[model samples]
Target: MTPHRLGIVGLGVISAAYLETLAACSTLVVTAIADLDPDRAAAVARTLPAAHPMTVAELLASDDVDTVLNLTTPAAHVEIALGAINRGKPVYGEKPLAVTLSEGRSILAAATQAGVRVGSAPDTVLGTGIQTARAAIDDGLIGRPVAASAVMVTAGHELWHPHPDFYYREGGGPLFDMGPYYITALVHLLGPIRSVTGASSRPQDHRVIRTGPRAGESIPVSVDTHVTGVLEHVNGALSTITMSFDSTATVASPIEVHGTEGTLVVGDPNTFDGPTSLRRVNDVGFHLLDPLAGYVDGARGIGLLDQIRAPRRGIARANGELALHVLDVMESLQRAASQGRRVETSTDADRPDPVPLTPRSEWLAVQH
Candidate 1:
């Protein structure tokens, strides 16, 4: 099979992981690269013999590029995606789809009109960790899920990220930056979100960098740092979510789902493989379940491969519709917080088909 040619835009921190993962996959090939900084793009190109650096405009117009990978920051997601769509190229991007739901909708609309595929991240859900939990739910092991809790807590990214300014801006925040992973996992385990009610806070106006050379420098926080919400799933399950940049620690499981017959502890949705445990009504404690679904030892670009496989199948698990729904759930949550009312979500997506356990060796051979 001829590998799908991918042109990558943006060489930020997240791009490194995608490059690493794509390097090992025979299903996709990185043929071109671009970044705002020419030097950075050249540096990335130097590492891949088949890839050459180009201006963002040049990369978008390259004949060898079949798909554009938008790894740009949240604010640039929509612009870059629109560029790719106008050029008639399929797009697979990093999460949040775009900074806002309106922008996200525009991207989808353009792609639909252009008749090209669209996919997005939080592909971690397509990994063993969350997929295994999803399998358990589908198998009736949990027996009618009732509610779920997802908690993610941290002091702030300014402490570690060298350039954390974007994190506090409109597109960035605890809710948008980290919410995709948890919410996407919930959608997989339960289903599409129907409505949301939320409350948010920004306890501090300014944050000081702790690491990096700019340590002690203050950055203004324009968006809420802490967000708590309840997402009503279409399946009638209610999921309570807490995403914070205000706290330092949390002992709660990353995610836990309760059902009539049992409780399930899902592993961190940000990771490919972790522990997924379950406890029945009569069980003394949660017991780890065997890995039952998803790509074992998976990595970031697995979603891109899924996209490559979609034409022969259908929509990839990490698809544009799912990303749009996740975005709708989040945007509604933000509005709910500001308006102090429950907001009905405008979009819905089907729970993607479960991935049967695909070991690394087998999944990698999907190139054919």
Candidate 2:
């Protein structure tokens, strides 16, 4: 098989993780890389013997590139993706798809017209952790899932991220930044969301950066920092979610699903493997479940891999439809919070097919 030639846009902190994963995969090859700061791109290119630094425009137009890996920031997602799609190259991007649902729709529409595919991140669901939990639910281990609760809390990204101003910006709140993981996992396990009721708060106007060269710097907060919502799934299951940058600690499980017969403590959706546990009716304690589905020890770039292996983008597990649906859920939740009313979602997605457990060697191997 011919390897998919990859042209990466944006060489930020998150790009480092993707590069590390790409180094181990065989299905794709990094032929070119680009960043707003050409020096940064060049620095990264030096580490990959075959990849060369180029301007963003040059990377988009390169004949050698079959795909564009968009690791740009939230605000730049749509613009970069449109550039790649217009050039007839398939594009995959980091989470939120775009800052707004309308922008995400535009990106998808443009890709459709250009005859190119689009994929989005938070592929962690493809990892064994959540996938195992999904397998359990599908196997009826939980026996009719009724409700779930997801919690994610921290002091704030400013505490450790070198440049976290974006975390508090319009598209960077706790919900938009972190909700995708929890919400996506929920959708995978239960089904698409039909509506949402939300409440939100921003405790401070500014935050002080506490790490790296930007330590002690103050950044303004323009979006809600603590967001709580209830997702009413189409399957009639309910999911309560709390994503906060205001709290320093919590003893709550990252996620838990309660059903008619049992309850499951789902592992972190941000990870690839799990120590997933379950407690049946009258059980004394939660018992660990073995890895049963998804890529073993998966990493950040698996969604792109799924896209590359697909015969058509629509069938890819992390296709644009799922990302667009996720974006719509988040935007509706935020609007519900701001308007003091429950909001109905305008989009929905069929649960992507479950992944059979893939051996570590196969998942990491480049198809030749």
Show pairs that collide, candidate 2: 1-368, 26-366, 27-366
**In order, what is each prediction's RMSD in angstroms?**
1.0, 1.3
Give one digit per residue, the lDDT tens place, for model 1 in 1-368. 78878899999999989988888877778999999999999999999878999998999999999999999999999999999999999999999899999999999999999999899998999899999998898889889999999999999999889889999998889999999999999999999999999999999999998888899899999999999999999889999999999989899999999999999998889999878999998999999999999999999888888887888777788999999999999999999999999999999899998999998876665542
Native-to-model Cα distance after best TM-score fit, residue 140 in candidate 1, in Å: 0.7
Q: How well is each residue in 160-209 modelled by candidate 2, as lDDT tens digits?
A: 89999888997898899999999999988998999999999999999999
Model 2 / residue 299 / CA error / Å:
0.8
Model 2 RMSD in Å is: 1.3
Clashes of each: 0, 3
Model 1: residues with Cα > 4 Å off, grouped in runs: 366-368
What C-alpha lDDT does candidate 2 achieve relative to the native structure?
0.91
TM-score of 2: 0.98
Highest lDDT: which candidate?
A: 1
